[model samples]
Target: MGRILLTGASGFVGGAIHEYLSNSSTHKLTVALRRPMSSLPVTTTLAQIDQIDGVTDWSRALLDSDVVIHAAARVHVMQESSTDPLTSFRKVNVEGTLNLARQAAEKGVRRFIFISSIKVNGEETSLGVPYTACAEPAPADPYGISKMEAEKGLMRIASESGMEVVIIRPPLVYGPGVKANFFNMMKWLYRGVPLPFGAICNSRSLVALDNLVDFVVTCIDHPKAANQVFLVSDGDDLSTTELLKKMGRALGKPARLLPVPSGVLTLAATLLGKKTLSQRLCGSLQVDITKNRELLNWLPPVTVETELDAVAKDFLDKHV
Candidate 1:
């Protein structure tokens, strides 16, 4: 294996990938990021990739790589209307992606690994039905739409460029240094806060950071993964109540789950416009990593129990 070029080296997901490759391998790692790589080790080269011009100025990073993992993406969050999210996503996900893919073909890179999201399949995975690699895409939000568009674009590039492409779609990743909802949960659990969540028995797909990175590295050279889309998970689905309980267990506290009816909670959340939490609590989005496990012959290295404990210990140690 030759040098590998990774974009979005500073993002949460990308940084995890960068950390994994940086500390665990002898293979050359090249990163294209906005800020300097001084924050990173000296061995990691700081390659500048101008966002607006990377399409035309990719020779710097895509020149000598065995593969290029496009982890950098424009994540569309709430209240991003003025941002013209579709165009913003296209600038990076589609145009930037093709630009690098074409350059890789010209530069003779062997493979292209893309970290996609499960949202491409849809915002809502049917109850009791697991989303699979063969499921058709039905993105509901701008972010999901952009990821879907980029996936199609990448497929076209892979078709025309004669380079192997491995696409991975992971759902709800959590681990050490975890932020967003996961961090919020840790905060709440640390304070021994009660949750109105026992009555909810919905399940959603989630992957631990280590498992995600492990799969990405596995697909890097696994021939079976070439030009294929794989849905990945921790190989086990956990309910919202179960997740909170696990967090409590990890924090050495007992979960305070109220036995309120699921419908009442959904109604109250809807009225309060807290639908995001509503859906996650009462929704279903399980992924059958059967394809990933059987095809790539890979299973997640970290179990949910271990991952949850590690997350709590790391956060508690840092914040305490």
Candidate 2:
């Protein structure tokens, strides 16, 4: 059993990780939170910090920790409010992450697991040519660029301090408690809204919340995971049309999709200043997890169909 410190305990992904680790008998879990909460499990310890930034002190949280899972960051926002988005992102994602990592290293933390996004590889990929861990980074957005910079800084810290770093880049993660676009799609489907995505055949990879949490736990003590970068997914790719149809099946409401050409949709979206949203729906972004399988012999424990069904059920339970 090892002592582990977890950040972002209140977030979607981080909450799930904390729940999973808190139930485990083999590890001692301590969570760093921006504020205190009364609902946390009694087995878990809390470390409160004012905010995450370049100079946030993490010394108290790093005490006697064997591994640090850095999951909190300035997440990507569809409608960005910041005038200088990159600067805003750098302050949190880049500077904040490096600060925590340096402290972890100095405190003799064995491994630091970073939850990165697949956007580091770029916005889109060729239909059949998914991105690999070794691919050159071509971040197109401020959020992606910030994560890339953080990864670079973490690697430098690892080399100089001998603290191992494990980076996992996951694409769109969806399951219960999901928000953003995925949840929007579910809402549209449930409302029987007609969507013009029947013709969108571009493939995209997605990871389930359970699968991602499982992989993070796997990397905690897996010797082979040290100093490695991995791209994780469900090992299944789906087009926008296919994904909606499957979600519809899970939700007990067949999607009402109108067959619209991808080009026409792109043009309309561009004219309406929603080009990025269109690209997300019409362009392919796939990640190859061959490295994950070969290196750690790891496989996603849950299937997409099962997880999607759960997501639908959860949505219905809460919304209906």
Q: Which candidate wins on lDDT?
A: 2
Error of 1 at 307 (Å): 0.6
The number of clashing residue pairs in model 1 is 0
Q: Single out the weakest 10-residue window by summed lDDT for candidate 2.
A: 36-45
Candidate 2 C-alpha lDDT tens digits along 1-320: 78899999899999899989989998998999989877767777899988999999998888889999999989998999999999999999999999999999989999999999998999999999999999999999999999999999999999999999999999999989899999999999999999999989899999999999999999999999999999999999999999999999999999999999999999999999999999999999999999989999999999999999999999999998
What clash count goes with each model? 0, 0
Question: Candidate 1 versus the native: TM-score?
Answer: 0.95
Question: Model 1, poorest ten-residue lDDT window?
Answer: 49-58
What stretches of model 2 exceed 4 Å from their correct place? Answer: none
lDDT of 1: 0.83
- State the local distance difference test value for candidate 2: 0.95
Give all TM-scores, in the order shown: 0.95, 0.99
TM-score of 2: 0.99
Task: Report the Cα lDDT for residue 274, model 2.
Answer: 98
